[model samples]
Each structure stands twice: as structure tokens, then as C-alpha cells.
Target: MTITTPNNSFNATLQDLIEYPANGINSTVLLKDNNSQYSLFCLAAGTNIDEHTSTRNAVITVIEGSGNLNLEGKDIALTPGVFIFMPANAPHAVQAKENLAFTLALSEHLPAKKGVSQKTIDIVKSTAPVIKQHGKTITTRMYEIMFDTHPEVKSQFDMAAQANGTQHAKLATAVYSYATHIDDLESLKAMVDKIAHRHVATHVLPEQYPIVGECLLKAIKDVLGDAATEEVMTAWAEAYQALAGVFINREQQIYQNAS
Candidate 1:
């Protein structure tokens, strides 16, 4: 639909935007800058785009299904994760073998940023099913362990909410949500920002993260018993710290703004 890049941080999962139209081909402009542009393209089976030339070097990244790229009279097969670097002024065309979808990146690409390790991402995704099934139980136990282990932190929570079990329920949902989205933190940016403001209001200190994190890991172990393997525990710990850093950094900014 409508595409506009506001002068703010932007984030999107490319796969989420891929959609074939009734017209056989659909394209969405994902991001645009003075020198860089990213677009997502979806094509129905047997669809073909006539050859076209770009003044800038464009990288074609196949995201789903199979396809072929005709680049300057040379044909190249396309598949999931395959990348073709087409030079500037080169004429190229795409022909979808099935319901193919791909991303087109144009610009001098910047170096990739570091994120949670692939192993951690895989572990989180694979373990999410099991954890979600027991999320409420684990979070319920987490608060008990936390308040008992450090009663001082209890006052930080709304006693009324805790009395009704809503506090535990919310945290439980958030915990599982974090696990599924650990690889795509940008998608959680708004939620993280809101939580950071709430944390700032409640005077949540950075040092308190370790206490909550420890109790959370222990709670998972206590609830799951033999099911919470060492590898699973390590992945959650890393994910928690990565998320904690997001909050801490945002809270610092909130504090700075207030002062």
C-alpha cells in the first residue's frame, strides 16, 4: 500500500510483507533512503517480469519458492536464501517457478550488525512450544521465588494486581513472548519502550535484573524439573540479558529526559 519512510528507526520482517496479488505480481517498498532502497516482491506461478536495468547495483535475495533470474542474458536459478549480486546498468528479469517471493536490495550495503547467535535463535524457537505450555506455571513460581528470595523487590509490583494473579499472568505471557521474538527484537521495540517507561516510574535499577533473571531461571527449572535442560537454561539466560539491555538503555534515556 502506502509507503513512506519517516525520519525514525524502521523495522520490519520481510517475510511478513510478501503477498501475491490478483494481478500476478505485487511489490512493496520496504525501506528508502537517499542511496538505499529495499523492496519485497511476490509473484504467482509462471509469472515473468520483463528485463529492466537499474543504475545502481541491486542484490536479489530469494526468500521463498523457486525462481530464475535472467541477468544480462545469463540465467541464474533462485531459491530460498540465494543471493545474486547484479552490477549497475545490468539488465535483469525474474521468472517465478511457483509462488515465488524475494527481496530486492539496492544500495551500498552496510556491514551487518551483531545479534543473538544462530544457535540461541534455533534453541529459542525449538523450545518455545514446550515453554508456552507451562508458561503460567513457570511465571507463577518465578514470582514466588523472587519475592521470597528478595522481599525488597515485592514492593515494586502492584500488590492489588498480584493479589488477583494478573501480575503473574502478565509476566508469564511476556516471558514467552520474549523467547519467540528474541531474534527479532525490533518487533518488540514498542513493548520494550513502554516497559522501560514503567520501569523508570517504578525506579527499577539495572542491578535488579540479575535477581529477577536468576529467580526466573530457577523457576523454570523448578517447574519443568528434568525437562529444563542446561542448554535450554543457557539460551533463556542469554535472551533475558539481551532484552534487559534494551530496557536498561531505554530507561537511561527516560531518566535523562526527565532530568
Candidate 2:
């Protein structure tokens, strides 16, 4: 059975999502409308949820059995009809003494930020296949546009190396590496650090980033042509900004430390 709201979203019953003896620790979402979410959790005896925190305020309604909920380093008794209100970012955990069931309701709260968002991650991931196919061409085009349009910025280039095509090849490899590892940036820390150091040595300035970004994005549009729709271009722009943030932040620190 379904209960549809005016917005076309529907309500879900907990019983419909799970049963007693879910046999182990089990959970299912009952509703997810905008900033509100509902989840059902069932745990067997001796089962537990380790400590964690939420970025949104949450409510827990115990439906059956008994448990001890550890909240902010303190344990609280939990039984049928017991309700727990947890403020955003609170550390909590649960342990089941017997078969236990509960409903978790999360209320709207300020959207919390940690790092680059999931949307951007997906956008970058979607481009990985296309990037893999045209990475070298895109980078080579980016250099041509950059050098041709901004000849004054050519002091940073090694003309002989660019002519030999090694520079474009290196830039292409770096761009592809970043696209593949966008989700796990920590893995690229050493390489990012090396790039930052080289940029600092080469007198790369913050103001010049936009120029490179424009050329690179246009180059992508040129190389991929019809495949680089506005959405794809927008996503690549965001990805570039995210990576530029990393590079710029590090370069700032390097410049500061040197001074």
C-alpha cells in the first residue's frame, strides 16, 4: 500500500520495510522527501551500531525490545515507545539486549558541508570515460589555445619541449589522473604538492588561473565537440574549480611559508 502526498512523493510503513528476526542487523529507508528522511533498523541480540555522528538533527522511536543507546559518551536506556532527540552532529551508538527495532527520523537542518559535494563527484566520474578517450587531444588543444591567445604568458612554457609534444603529453596524463582520482584526492597529495611547488617556482599567480580555465574548457568543447554539451562543460568547469581550489590553497601556503 502507498500513501501519496500532493507533491507525488509517497509514505512508507516500517512493517512493509522489515520483519522481526530480520535475523541480523538490518535497516531500510521508509521515506526520503527533501530534508526529511525515515529509516527502519532491526537488530538481533548482542548486535550494535558503533559510534557515529549526524550532520542533521534526528529522532529515534523505539518500536520493540530493549537496548542501550550511547549518546555523547553516555548510555541511555531504550524501550518500547521511548523517543530520543539528537541535535545535529551528536555522537551516538546503540546496542541491543534482545531483538530490537526502531524508526529513525531526521529533521531538516542547515546543510552541512565537508568537501566537494556528491553532485560534483558524479559529474567528474561521468567525464572519466570521455576524458579517457580524448585526454591527449584535449590537453594539446588547451595548450594551443593558451599559447596562441595569451602569447604574453608564454614565459612559463618550454617551446622546445612543447614542440617535441612532451609537455602536452604530460599535461594530458596529469588531467586524466586527476579525473580518475577525483573521489580519492588524498591519493594524489604527493603529486599535487609537487605541482604546487613547481608552480611556485615558475611564478604562477592566482589571477592567471581563470585564463587557463577558459582555454581548457573551450579546448574540451572543441575536442569533444557535440559530446561536450553545456552540462558536460559546466561539470568540467566545476571539477576544474575543485582542483584549482586544491592547487591554489597549497600554492598560497607555499608562498606564505617562503615569505
* Candidate 2 lDDT tens digits, 1-259: 2233236656555556656564568777776554566778889878888776664689999988899999999889989999999986577889999888899988754432335667777877888888878988998899889989889889987789889988788778778888888889899899899989989998986547766887999999999889888887887877786677678677877986896
Error of 1 at 1 (Å): 56
Q: Per-model C-alpha lDDT, please?
A: 0.79, 0.79
Once all C-alphas are superposed, what RMSD does model 1 give against the true structure?
19.8
TM-score of each: 0.55, 0.55
Let me know the TM-score candidate 2 reaches against the reference structure.
Answer: 0.55
Clashing pairs in 1: none
Q: What's the C-alpha lDDT at position 99 in model 1?
A: 90
lDDT of 1: 0.79
Worst 10 residues of 1 by lDDT: 107-116
- Model 1 residue 104 distance off true place after TM-score fit, in angstroms: 52
Which pairs clash inside model 2?
Answer: none
